[model samples]
Target: MHHHDNPPQSVPSSPAYIRATWGGTGSVEEASAAFGFSRAKGYDLVRRGEFPCRVLRIGRSTRVVTASLLRVLDSGEPEYSGTRDAHTAPA
Candidate 1:
């Protein structure tokens, strides 16, 4: 048996679902899950100021901009970069 205080929610990687969640703001964990990374990696990106999307920080909490997340997903690119990397670059 397992007991958890706050269990992770299923975050669908759909634009419609994202647009409807939290009125345009989501937690770092949710964003990370959608991006296929661990929550710790997401927070590490935030701490290092390298997160792919725009973030709103207040006190000790961080929130990812829904629009930015959507942009990253829809465009297949990180918001911070104008050029694609080796994985996405042309041959």
Candidate 2:
């Protein structure tokens, strides 16, 4: 079990909420919260290079790439964004 002075923010899974709430980058805690996990686990994943999305380490600070996080969240979509329609025949 893990504990924190401040719990992570429970961001909605919707893309619109992600776009509206986060900028180009956000904290690892926020990313973990989006996935319904603890920040410690998130940091562990980051250290092991197994995080679900891209993470950048600048000096002692770690930042999650919002675009990568959003991509991970959008994985359930039938077709990737900017890709051809899934039901359409190839040209």
* Candidate topping TM-score: 1
- Deviation of model 2 at 88, angstroms: 40
Tens digit of per-residue lDDT, candidate 1, span 1-91: 8878885664575676787665678999988888889999999877666688878887888888898989998888877431333343323
Error of 1 at 24 (Å): 2.1
Candidate 2: residue 45 lDDT (0-100):
72
| Residue 38 displacement (Å), model 2 | 0.6
Q: Whole-model lDDT, candidate 2? A: 0.73
Q: Candidate 1 clashing pairs?
A: none
RMSD of 1: 8.9
Tell me the alpha-carbon RMSD of every candidate: 8.9, 11.3
The TM-score that candidate 1 achieves is 0.69
Clashes of each: 0, 0
Clashing pairs in 2: none
* Number of clashing residue pairs, candidate 1: 0
Which digits, one per residue and each the tens of the lDDT, describe model 2 over residues 33-88?
Answer: 88778999988877656678877778999888889888887793321221223453
Number of the top lDDT candidate:
1
